[model samples]
Target: MSYSVESVAYWYLSKEEMSPKKLQKILYYAYSWFLTLQNESSDELENKLFEENFEAWVHGPVINSVYDQYRHYGYKEIDKFEGDLPKFDSEALDVMEQVWEVYGGYSGNELENITHQESPWLNARKGYQPLDRCRNEIEDKDIFECYIQRVN
Candidate 1:
């Protein structure tokens, strides 16, 4: 079963208040590992939790849509989600849980520094300088391949 990015975002926000940047990084990691492990488990792209693409933003990978949804909040911690919690498949929930366990401690800036050194973000920003404005879409193939190689 798949879930929307908003649903996943809410799940993260539900655990702790976070800046939009932190939310975006957590979501990216969740999606990355889920994509990597899901393929090894089932070998199918159709099982992706969300279809939304992430742009290689200066801070890191950002889902433009999700970022826009919280842009008004600026750098402050986004308000706690007021909506009822959403449901998830066991596998999806596990992936999210594991993602939090691994990444929840880092602040937005720390995660940004970490992603800056990663291949997916680096490849997407290819030919672009550190401060260059870029919105190049990070390919799912590159994300999956790059992350899978690192993990295995």
Candidate 2:
């Protein structure tokens, strides 16, 4: 069963207070890796950790809901999520852990830079130039193949 993106967002925010930007990128990576690792689509309802689709915003892939919830913090670190945490299936837990271990160290700026260089975001924002405000939805297939290439 898929949890809300807010639940997973709080899960990551519970781990560390990140700027809305970083949390967005981490969640994007988590979603992408889960797709590649499980060999499933984010559209596969039973397999999704959350139902949210990411938009290729100027910074990176931003989940509109997550961004709206924390956008008030601007570039500042979002305050600790003072509420419920998430329970994950073992596979989802492993994917999130692996994402954290690898991408967690980077700042929001760095993660944004990294995602900007990636195909999922680039493909979605193809017609828009850098610094362009594009809200095109990122395709999960592109993201799945993008991360799979890194693994192979």
Choose the strongest candidate by lDDT: 1
List where candidate 1 sits over 4 angstroms from the true fold: 41-44
lDDT string, candidate 1, 42-124, tens digits: 23556677889889988999999998899998999997777898889888999889999999999999999999988889999
Report RMSD (Å) for each prediction in the order shown.
1.8, 2.1
Q: Show the colliding residue pairs in model 2.
A: none
lDDT of 1: 0.89
Question: On residues 7-81, what C-alpha lDDT tens digit does candidate 2 reach at each position?
Answer: 778878888788888899899988888878886543542466677899999989998878788889998998778
**On a 0 to 1 TM-score scale, where does candidate 2 land against the true structure?**
0.91
lDDT of candidates 1 onward, in order: 0.89, 0.84
Error of 2 at 36 (Å): 1.0
